[model samples]
Structure formats: structure tokens, C-alpha cells
Target: MQSDPAAMPAPAGPRENRAVLVDVALALVIGWILGAAAQVAHWSGQLAPGRRHGPGPTGNEAGHDWPRWAEGMGQPPPGVPWPALIAAVVILLAVALRRAYPRAAFAGALVGAIGYVAAGAPFPVTLIPLALCGYAVAGREPLLRWLPIGVLVLPLAVAGWWQEAAVGLTEPGPYGVLLITAAVLASATMLALLRRARRDAHDRERREELRQAALGERLRVAREVHDIVGHSLSVISLQAGVALRVLERRPDEAAAALRAIRGSSTSALTELRQTIAAFRDDPGRGPTAPPPGLDRVDELAAALRAAGREVTVERWPDPLGPLPASIELAAFRIVQESLTNVVRHTDRAGAAVLLRRTGDELLVEVADDGPPLAAEPTPGGGLHGMRERAEGAGGTFAARRGERGGWVVSARLPIGEAP
Candidate 1:
């Protein structure tokens, strides 16, 4: 019995699930760290008095020199009960949605960054979520779409700095902040592009592998169809010719030949349908019938004898032990093709088939005792296919003129036993 190909297990789900989990966990961890840092900076600002206006007693601020938007305003800044809570929620939401909806998450993160700046937060705190979102967007979106967005970072930073300057609230480090923001965005975009390129390379390699595998399967099926139809048609053609020649003198013999032709045609049609169905990917078609093998050799010899050829088969190891079906099929095809060649190329030739198993190898040999034909036989698809089948089964095949002056074909197939 043949097993259904559809019954094989699928391996895609678990790997994809694991990747999603990893991305989500990493996002959460990064969001947590950024939120904690923002909270610490907010607390430091609250504890220091007049520090936003000028340097502290140490002649330097606790954070970098970026201008603070809240310090220059005449009115006191509105207080939030939990400033970190808003930033944390926004950052986490953006990260969680990054993989599934990258563009939306990226836009949300940009809005959050603008809100952070407007709320008088530190510049470094605003950068965390923006950088993460930029990376996500670059990874998913095409270069033409995301590259321009990345380039806009420089102009946006300059505009914000210019607004601060118009109000006489600009610090001496406007260019420093602009360059830093641009560098962050550029670096994130470049890394994401590299990752996308690597993923594309891997996808291409996988597709190539699948294509080559499909091509190899096609060749294998073609070879099988060629051997089956070729051998069967050869037998049928020879039988039809015999039936035509004897139709006038021997009516009974002609009838028998016609019956043999019908039998061969019917068997070929059945096998052709099975071969085609095997190639179909539909599970509803069910299992295919087992392929022909050594057990059918007797039926093959009988058919040839009925077609006016004298053929003998010998099995030295009678009641042969179990063998792999592939080896058996290759063996059967070699013998079948050899007999078919004899019928086509020789007149009244008698052939002998010998099958023997010794140790780890199964041997098959076919020899004909007829005199050489007037023309030398040219190698054709049959000979090339036989060699391929034997080698594909991890076996060896040879065809040459025998010492007794007739064509001999031989093959030795490995039986999966330890050598």
C-alpha cells in the first residue's frame, strides 16, 4: 500500500510562532527600559530648583545641553499625575503592533514623539520610541517609501529648533541635537535595510531549492512513464505485426495475437492512469496502487512467449526475501526493456533472465542467444533510462556484447544491508 503525500506533517507553524513570541518579548523589554529612564529624568527635573534656567552648582546640568521647552514659558507647566504612564502605554502599544501593522505603529510612534516634545520631556526620552518605530518601518516597507521618511528627520528637527529660536528659547546646541537625531534615524534605517536584505536572500535560496526539487521529481516521473509506455508499446506493435501476417493462414493464431495486444494495451492504460494520479496533489484521490516489481516478471515472460518470443526466467534464490520496492521496480524495468529490445532488434532470438541475491546485493542479468543483427544497435533513450534507474536506486548497470556473441544487460542493486 502507498502512503498519501498529504498525510505528511506540516512544519511551518511552530517556527513562525516562536519568531513572533521573540519579537514581542524583545519589544516589551526595550519599552520597559525606555520608560524607566524617562521616569528617572522627570524625577531629577522636579527635585532641582532653578536648574532648568542655568547650570547647577557643579556648573553643568544633570542631562545633556539640549534646550528645554518648558523652562522658558512664563506660565508654570501643567503637571501630570503619572507622566511615565502615558509614555509607557504609547511605547508598548507601538511595539506590540509593529510586526502586524508596521506603518500604523510607526505613525503612532511619531505622534507620540511629538507629544513627548510638546510635554517638555527630554530629547533622549523622545528618541527611544521613534528609533524603534523607524527600525520596524524600514524592515517592512520598501526603500523608496521609508527612505524619504528617514531623510525627513533632519528637516523636522531643524523646524523644531527654529521654532525654539524664534521665541529666544534656543540653546547653543541646536546643530548638535539635529545631527544626533539624524544619526539615530539613519542608523536604525540602515540596520533594518540590512536585515530585510538578508531575509530576502534567504527567501530566494529557499525558492530555488524548492524549484530544483520540483524539477527533479518531474524528471523522475517522466522517466517512469517513458519506460512503461515504451516497453508496452513495443510488445503491442510486435504482436500486431504477427497478427497481420498470420491473419490469412492461421486464423486462430491471429486471434490469439489480437487478444495479447488487447491485454498489453489495457495494462498500459491502467498503469498510465495510476502514474498520472500519483503525480496529482489532491488528497481526495487516495493512495496509488503499488508499482510493478520482480513478482511480475513471470507475467512479463508469459506475455513475450505468447507474442512468439522464446523467453526463460531463472531465480536462484527462490522465495526471495523482502526487498525495497524501488530496487524491485528498477530490476523489473531493466528486464522488461531488455526483452522488449530483443523483440524489436532480433529475429527469432531466445533470451534468458537470471535473478540472484548474494549478501547485500541483488543481481539481474538478461542475455540473448540470437546472432548479431545486420546493423549495429545505437544507444537510445532506453539505455540511458536504464542506467539512470539503476544509479538512482544506488545500483550499477552495464550493457555490452556478451562473450557468446549476443547483447547482455546486467545490474546489481544494493539491498540496504550493511556493506
Candidate 2:
């Protein structure tokens, strides 16, 4: 048994079908220009007016006197044949296909021009298709290959010889119209080249923009992982050490230390999975907690307390209403990273976390009574990640030695329009 070919759905249209429609209109206009010019006169000596040749074309006959020097010699036809007219219609249809098949259209038109002369046919009209085709294909191809298309102008000049025979003419002479034809083709080719160049430049800029956006996103994810996993691992290491030291004596205290380790590890793994899923664009994974924000800063301090470090938080003009999500996230991460650094780099040092808000800005500061902080960041360092988050949120960041002792980290983030 055979399947029905017509039953299959048609393939979707090209991405740029709108351009193809414009080409159809351009094709019709070119067809009219050539069609109107072909009907202007018949220069064949046998068909000239007052000759005995059977019934010359009755309309649009030329008023100029025939050249005296060419009384015997033949002149190229000012009109084209029926076959040439049909070829032109086919050429016009090809012109409409220019958007999708520009090379084919140009090749067909070039072939038509060369075919007319190769068959010994005489006419100025045959070359019009080649000039029209140049608008679409000439500039798109290499210069060395398409230059030959300009050679057809010689025959056009000879066919227009009657323009020279005209006496007292205000219009251009024989080569004047020829110059105009060449000018038209040249203008078309130059314009095509310019458009192609502009499109190429736009493509380059778009690719660069996309590359930068991806880089920024990856850096953002790295900062997130650094802050989340770094803080949790610090607490786990401290709690595990405590549990091992008291395993034999003080069993209850050891059990409590182990429980803290389990809790810290579980929360860190969940947050890590969420960040990885977002980076991979995996929406179907397990539902995740909302991003940590300024509201979670107290939780960070409480965790540090569990790891046997004292953290004091002070807020002035407490933020009664919700701030923009970006500012909140940046502020929370700054505090979390500062505390983590104290835990990892110092021996049970006490820390202070401070947050304040103004009309349109939030200020976050963290200070540890430990040795001076030295930030020689290598890719995913805590100080660098905090600075990046602050600046990315359209804010400022600073890390400097405290006036009396220790190290201080501060950030200022603006509250922009919220979604």
C-alpha cells in the first residue's frame, strides 16, 4: 500500500518571508519598465514606417528621421520578439524568488541576456533583466566573479545608436542613455553591498553581547556557591571537630555536635542543588526555597553562634517595608561571606553585623576582631564575590582595616524599581 503525498503538512515558511513579499513588488515594477520600453519603437529597416513590409506596429512610432548612412545596412530591433517577452515574464517570476534564490535569479537573467545575442537576435530590451538581477545578487558574490556581468553594456550602446541619429534632441545622445543604464546598475550593486556590510556588523555585535551576558551569569552562580557552601562547610568542620573531641566523655554534647553537622550539611546540599539547577536551566527539579535575603541575616548570625562565635547585629530605622529583591540579596550575601571568612581564617573571633537603610539605599557592614583581612582573590574568593555582588546591584563596596583593630567589610546598594 502507498501513502498519500498531499496529506503531509507543508513545511513552515522561511524566517524572512516578509522580505520575499517586497521582492515580488520589486519584480512587477522592473517588468513594467522593460515592458514599456520594448513597445517604444521598431528600428528594423524592413519594418520601418513607409516601407512595404506587411503592417508595421501601428502605435508609438518614432518621429526622428532615419539615418542617411544606414539606408542599406541593418539596425538592431528597438522591439523584442514574442519568445523574448515570454523569457522576460519567466525572469520577472525569478526576480520574485530573489530573496530565497538570488543566485538562481541572477544566473537566469544573465543567461537570458547572453542567449539573446548568441542566437543572433537583435534588441536593447534583452539586457534589462541582467541589470535588474544585479540589485539582488551582484554585491553578494565575489568581485572577480560578478565583474563580467558589466560587459553586456557594449551591445546596449550599439542597439541605442538611434539616439545619435536624432536631430536637435534635448534628451541624451546615444551613449547618454547607455551611461544612465550603467549608473543604475552601479547604484544597485553599491547599495546591496552596503546593506550586506551593515547586517554583518550587527551580527558581530549581537554575538558579543550574548557572550558577555553568559559570562556574567556564570560569575553570578560562582559567587552564590562560594557564599552558600563556604559558610555551611565552616560550621560543619567546627562541629565535627567538637563531636570527635568529646566522643568518650560528655556523650550528650557529642551527639548535639553531630546533629549540628548533619543539619548544616543537609541545608548546604539543598541550596547547592538549587543554584546548579538554575545555572543548568533545569526547571523540573525539586522545588527550592526562595533566595536568601536581608531578612535571613539573623539566621546567618545564629549559625555563627552555633559554631562557637559571637555575632552582634544592629539595625537603625529598621526597614519596615520590603526593599528591592536585588538589594536584599546583595546585603545578605555580604554579611554571610564576611562571617564565613572570620570563621575560616581566625580562632573563635567575635564579629559584628550592621545594616542600615536610607530613603533609596541600603548599607551593610561586617567587622571582625581578627587580624587584618588580606584579599588576594583567586577566581572564587569570598572578598571578591562580595564586591562583585555589591557592584552588580548598582552599588559600592569596600574592605579596609578597622580604626582600632581587625578588618571591616561594607557595601552600599541602591533600591531600584522593583518587579
| TM-score versus the correct structure, for each prediction | 0.76, 0.76
Candidate 2 lDDT at 7 equals: 91
Write the residue-wise lDDT of candidate 2 on 1-419 in tens digits: 78788997666577556677777887788667544443333333222112222344443242234532245545554445554455556667767876566667776665554433322233455445566577778656766676775666544444323223332133344355457657777887888789888988999999999999999887888789888888999888877877888899989888988888888899889889877876775667766667778778887777677667899998867753678777787888889888888888788788998888777888889988876545532334787788888888999998878765678889988976656
TM-score of 2: 0.76
Candidate 1 lDDT, tens digit per residue, 1-419? 99888997666588767867876786688667656655555543532111143335332244333224344544433444264547556767777777777777776666555444433445566566678788889999986765555544544344334334342235544456567777887788889999999999999999999999999899889887987898899889888989999999999999999999999999999998998887888978778998888999998898889888899999978967788988898999899888888887787888999999988899999999888534445678888888988999999988888766578889999998521
Per-residue error for 393 in candidate 1, Å, reads 1.0
lDDT of each: 0.74, 0.69
Local error of candidate 2 at 58, Å? 19
- The RMSD (Cα, Å) of candidate 1 is 7.2
